[model samples]
Target: AASSGDLNWSLNPTYTGCSITGAVGSQVLSCSLGTVAGNTTLPVIHVQSATTPADCGVVSNQATVATTNGTGGDSDTANVTILCPGLAIEKTADAASVTVGSTIGFTVTVSNNGAGTATGVDMSDPLPTGPGITWSIDNAHTSGPLSCVITAGTLHCTGSLDAGETQVVHITSPTQWTGSGETEVNSCLGGTDNTGVYDNTAQVSASNVTGTPNASAQEAVLCPDLHVTKVADDASVDAGSPIGFVITASNTGDAPATGAFVNDPLPTGVDWSIPEGGSTGPLTCQISAGTLTCSGTLAPGASQVVHITAPTTFADCGVYNNTATFTATDSPQTPNDSDSTSVLCAALTLSKTADAASVNAGSQIGFTVTASNAAGGSVGTARGVVINDPLPSGTGIDWSIASGPGNCSITGAVGSEVLHCTAVDLAPGASESVHVVSATGNTSCATYPNAASLTADNAPGLSANASTQVVNCVIVSPPSPPKQHHPAVLPNTGGPDGRLLGLATGLMVTGGALVLGDRRRRRRS
Candidate 1:
């Protein structure tokens, strides 16, 4: 019998199987064992019967046993070693170009290609044009020949590189833009690319600047100028009448002449007199103002003429002289000029009023007057220029009111003795006057109006006014007298023209920045 989990030892004689060997008293035995963990017993044991009754090495009591080595589990172990690359230089930028005196940028990279990591990498470079380039540690851009080291393009670069880690070095050159040549920048110590760095220079050029380019720059222009001349009409004339003369002014300069005035100075014997308001600027004759004042602009080589009548009574008129003075000034450019005509004085002879004149006291009568010039100007060849008939002595007029209407008497201003006389004359050799009708205000009087003179010649006893009362007159005589013009000098040493010449001669934001890498020392594997 057996229980599931229990062990029991038992002996059975019928199931015996055994073997044993011993001495003479030895015997054979057969035995069997059961499941050791659960059953501990012998199935049977057979032994040979021998002389010794107790010879069966008798298995005293059946027993069970087991054995195991004193060991727990399993264990194993392994070990190994490795290496990284060393630090080496690298160049991101090898070359560049710029206009002369200009600037450019580049980069240099350093890598830790070694067995171990490296820290605090540095970089730098050299320059030819020292002032044109700057070196940066933690590469930074700077003017003048400079060198520097960088970490991430920064000057304040503080970086570390493990084995195979890389840092970049930057380079920048700001030039002064001067030359037209080229040069190369070489890698000195920390060349990341191990190549060349260079900047090529070019020449400078310029173009014309347009309109008011510079504030103080003046506007440029060309000026114009002119010329003038004067001449008499007749070859000769009587002693007491009128003379003829002409003035011609022209533009002769290359440029246009504007704001100009023509001045003609009158001669002593032959007066270049002007009308009441006609005479302007003290006998410095003006075409418009009669005394030589004119308003106009003249083109190059252009010409104009002024006709004049010279009333004369020959007290002294052999040769009368005069001249045309043309002055001009223009705008934009500086300008100055003055011109004049030639000189001449003519002769004259006077015829008196038959020595003693006779006329009705109440009835108007007349007298004769004449004039002449050696330069060929004439007036009254016949009758010796009678001082117009009936009106001579009877008329009354006022010379005071030169232009407007006013009370009139035969009396002329300036108490001119010649004007006082009913008739008067002024010629070179002959000077005389005549008294006609003695009537007071019975008829109009005076050969000329209250008129002053345009150009008057002198006559003895005849007031300058008496013979010169034709200044404001429009109608003119032919064969003008030659004016004893003092041919206007170029006014270098004398005259107001020179004084004016003396007066005119005088005039005398912020952006960002990029930096470069660390200074890395290269090492071998």
Candidate 2:
């Protein structure tokens, strides 16, 4: 017999000669045999109907047998123990995949599935590390008597749960996502895959149970990164000269980047033309309204280059710093690069020419100095143009501003003086000249060399040299006059007339004495 409201038991096989009877929670068994042989055994087996946490620890069962008429009886007892309280945990996330910089939300549920209440139960979910990653627990949204807290980047919950009871905990990063498990900045993984993957696991255990079931959730992160670089063929370019620019753009993320483009505006007097191949990869380029634009799509780890051919005839002289920006669908910010090139305009030239290569001693010689601004490759005006001509050290040289379209002037005295010609501004294809006339000094059989230099505000300086030879001691013969025949013989006017003699005498006084002497000798013969 058993007490009321206790575990019940029943026999598996019914014995033909025995009978069994019992209430719901209490039962009894009886067996009878007539004239049983000595040392013969009779089977007695029983099965438990139900058990609970209250029935755990030290349980016992006893059996008694009696021979016909209760002549003899024997009893035996057996003891057994029962264990209870088991824990199980499951984890789930809101999304299976997310962008590199996005946050994720997770839910963890722990249940006590065993027959007894579980005390001192603990649940832990450790977060993965990434760029700017953070984790937090949402206590307000949690269920059950569990108190959740975060320490060392992990979320922990501890409490007690009754049989068939469950505790729900919500995990997230409050800084970026309030209801999510954690927030990640997604600093690139730095590989061709351009992806980040991690797993979050939640485990539950109780004081009575050392081992428990744990669940995990996996997530795959993805994003696209864009980068750009720009360079020029020549840093310093002349006006109207061809120049080339190279622009390189790439995507380092796992996903493809779209709507990628570059924008560049040309400076004044600068012309642009599409390159021979246009652009590399899947890019197309065009120039409109002095602005160049190139667009294309970029695959993961793909790069595109755009070459621009431009002729620059800028009217200004300074540095031209150009910047190009790269952006993509998944890029959070624009990446930009800059390349600078300098332009030099206006071309000025100077030249000096003497009227005669040789001159008599004491005779005046004339020289002309010219300064010009070339037009073909020049875009700017030559401002503050100045031409300087240094003369021989003597008082016989005289100079004056010859001709110019711009306001011009000449300063400085003769001889040891310098001829200075200045203009406020000289346009391209414009020129100015200064005439220098000098009297030959008493020193004969000598040569005088002169040099003139020019400079402009927008062009490099120039210099020119000219030389004049003065010879007064050489005897040069004169050409004979043509003979005349008038039917008969005419007067010897070609022989040597008084006028010719006077011409010879004047020539002798002017360093042409050689001609005069030759003429006189011919007349005497």
Give the whole-model CA lDDT for all candidates, comma-separated: 0.36, 0.67
What C-alpha lDDT does candidate 1 achieve relative to the native structure?
0.36
Q: Return the top candidate by lDDT.
A: 2
- Per-residue lDDT tens digits of candidate 1, residues 1-525? 111111122333444333333333222233443334433543434222211112112223222222343242232322212232344543433233332233345454555555444444333233223323453433242221212333442342234556655555445545331222254332221122321224222111111101111001111112343455666655555555566556666665544556666666555555554445422221133433235444476666666666666566545345555565676544212222322222223233433232123322223333333333233333322222223221222234222212211211234333241222222333334433333222223233224322112123332222122221111112222433443324344434345332322222211101111222232222211
lDDT of 2 by residue, 1-525 (tens): 433345666556656566557775556766666677678776655545455545566566676877766678888977665546778888987677665446656889998887677888888777765554566667776887777888887888898888888889887642111111244244344212433555788888777665767899866556667788989877766544566678888888776666767676755455667768757777677788987777877777888887777665435455667777877545554788888776657667788899899887777776788887778642446667777777755434455544443444445555557776654566778878767676665444567788888876556778999988777655555666755333332245354332322123434455434444433322211
lDDT score for candidate 2 against the true structure = 0.67
Which 10 successive residues of model 1 have the least lDDT summed?
209-218
Provide the lowest-lDDT 10-residue window in model 2: 174-183
Best by TM-score: 2
